[model samples]
Target: MARWKVNLAVLCIGQFLVMSGMTMITPFLPLYIQEMGVTDPHHIALWSGFIFAGNFVTSFFFQPLWGRLSDRYGRKVMLLRSSFGMAVVMTLMGFAHDPTQLLLLRILNGVISGFMPAAVALISTNTPREKSGFAMGMLQSGGVAGSILGPFIGGLMAEWLGFRSIFYVTGALLFGASMVALFLVKEKFDLAEAKKKTNITIVEGFRVLMKVKQLPALYGVTFVIQFSMLAAMPLIPLFVQDLHGKGELLAFYAGLVGSVTGFSNMIASPLLGRWSDRIGSVKILAVCLIGAGLCYIPQALVTNIWQLFAARFMLGVFMGGMLPSVQTLIRSYTPNGMESRSYGFNSSALSLGNMMGPIIGGALSGWVSIRGIFIMSCIMLLGNALWVRRTLSDPQLPKQTIQKAGSASHSGDDT
Candidate 1:
């Protein structure tokens, strides 16, 4: 295998382990908080949100820092650092005796959380430009697969071994993933080049990226996609109940409805990614955005559980194409030698979206109807598709516009 291919394979497994480890707590987070002695329902909900948000809150600020370090040192080292740091934090969570301890550990986990992004930076920088879409798509599948399986595995473990054991298992998996990255991932980083760029502040880096015409728009797309997708998440179970009229197996049905999209997404990501390589990432992105946006309309209007499920599954298929295409576009536009920092900033945008999406969804579901949230999501996506269509049509926009912008900025700096 080629070195890039080998790196891809190793990173895939590492990404899977890291993602699964992160998500394993999702299935039973409230229960874990209760075990830590938070008995009030209101407090449980509050603590749950706080603990969950804690990671992303810290990660949003820290990702760029890690990305910059990755640029200076190497993506592999950043990956190892994140994996090992996460492993330690997760293991400590298993020993937490109180909500405060758990919350602090969760915050620490956020501070250390960059494994997947670092892996992305590594793969994006290392892969041949021609194969970037396929590599990123295959890489995405690993994370999706991990996310799909993590809840199931965590639920089973919680039943058999208890919640604390789930933390231990997750920690062990992360440690093993770090070991794989340490032994297998290879990089041809130009240390001299990295050294030269090290003095550039993160603010300066963003200024450089912001001058690129397409990058800000692409970041907006990331936020919109995540925001639209998640805006319906907090209401899905309630929607399922509304459709199915509630039963003892309501939770099961809701879980199934949720998993269908992930299943379809996992199946479609690599296929569409390869397709994007053959066609163009921007074209695939536009098509998928429109497709997914339309799919949400059916979901909003669905009269039955099966209809809703089908719509969500179809949405997942289009969504599978979305992120990889975005990543491909980011790669195409970013100047060489800055891939990691650029991706890091993109990751921060993604994390911000993740943090905001559910909140927006929750607020919308509260203020309006659940179905209305779906409609809102659909509108956002369709509008975003239009934005993408207009902004990203010319592939040369970045190269031409950014060069002029950079020269002008340099002149200003000189003056």
Candidate 2:
């Protein structure tokens, strides 16, 4: 296999492990807090939201700094740095005895954790331009698969070994992933060239990148996608309860509600990526935004759990295309030697969206009703789609594809 393909495969595994380790705590986070001696139900809920958002909060601020480092030092070292740091923090969470300790540790994890963005930067910068769409699609598929499986695995491990022990196992798995990357992935980085840009401040980096007309719009697309998707997701359980009733199996039904979307997204991402390689990602992105936005309406209107399930499945199909398209477009627009920094800033936008989405959804859900919150999300996404269509530039064909087209035209003339 080519070196870029090898790196892609390595980073796909790395992304899977990173996503799994992060999400394993999701199923038992509140329960773990209760076990750690938070007795009041209200406090448990408040503390849970706070601790959960803690990671994204710090991540939102720190991604640019890491991106700049990755550009200067090499993406491989940044990958190692993040994986090891997150591994240690995840292990320490196993020993946390109180909510404050857990909260603090989660906050710290956010500060140190950034394997995905760096992996993305590595792959995007190193892979052939024609293959960026496929690489991103496959990587997203790997991460989604991990997200689908992680909760199930964590739940089983928590049942058999207890909640705290799951953290130890998660830590070990992350460490193993770092080891794999440290040995297998290859990057043809120029240390001399990289060092020349080392002194550019993050602000300066942003200034330079923003001069690319399409970049800010692409950044907004990244943020809006996350914001619109996540804002609706945290409310799925409550909406499921409304449609299905609060049976003992309600949580099971809600889990299905969420996982089915991921399942379908995994199916759709690569297909869309292939299509993007031919027709252009910007077109696919606008279509995906519109399709995903339309899919949200049925969720708000569903009268039963089955209806909701079908709606979410359709939503996933469109959702899969959104992120890979945005990532591909970002790479297409970014200048050479600054790819990592652009990805880093985009990651920050994504993290900010992640941090704010749930908070706004939670805060507004009761006032506007869950259904209303869903409507608001739908409007935001559709509006974003319009903004994307109106503002972003037309996609340029990949150089290889253009060369092939020119060759075919000359052959036709000769015939």
RMSD of each: 3.0, 8.4
Instruction: Tell me how far candidate 1 lies from the true structure as C-alpha RMSD in angstroms.
Output: 3.0
Per-residue lDDT of model 2, residues 1-415, tens digit only? 9999999998888888888887778888889999988889999999988888888899888888788788778988888999999989999999999989988998998888778778988898888888888899999998888888888899899999999999999999889988889999888899887765345566666666776767888888888878877887888888899888877899889989979999999999989988888888988999999888888888788899999999889989998998899989887777666677788889899988887787788888878877887788788888988888876755552222212223333221111
Model 1 per-residue lDDT tens digits across residues 1-415: 8999999998888878877777778879999999888899999989988988898899999888888788778988898999999999999999999888998998999898888778888888889988989999999999989988988898999999999988988898888878877888898898876765454667767887887778888888888888887878878998899999966888888999989999999899999999999999998999999999899888879999999989999999999999899988987887766678788888899889899999978877777787888888888889988888887877574543333334444332211
Instruction: Give TM-scores for every candidate, taking all chains together and pairing residue i with residue i.
Output: 0.95, 0.92
Off by over 4 Å in 1: 397-415
- lDDT (CA) per prediction: 0.85, 0.83
What would the TM-score be for candidate 2 when compared with the true structure?
0.92
- Cand. 1 Cα-lDDT: 0.85
The residue pairs that clash in candidate 2, if any, are: none
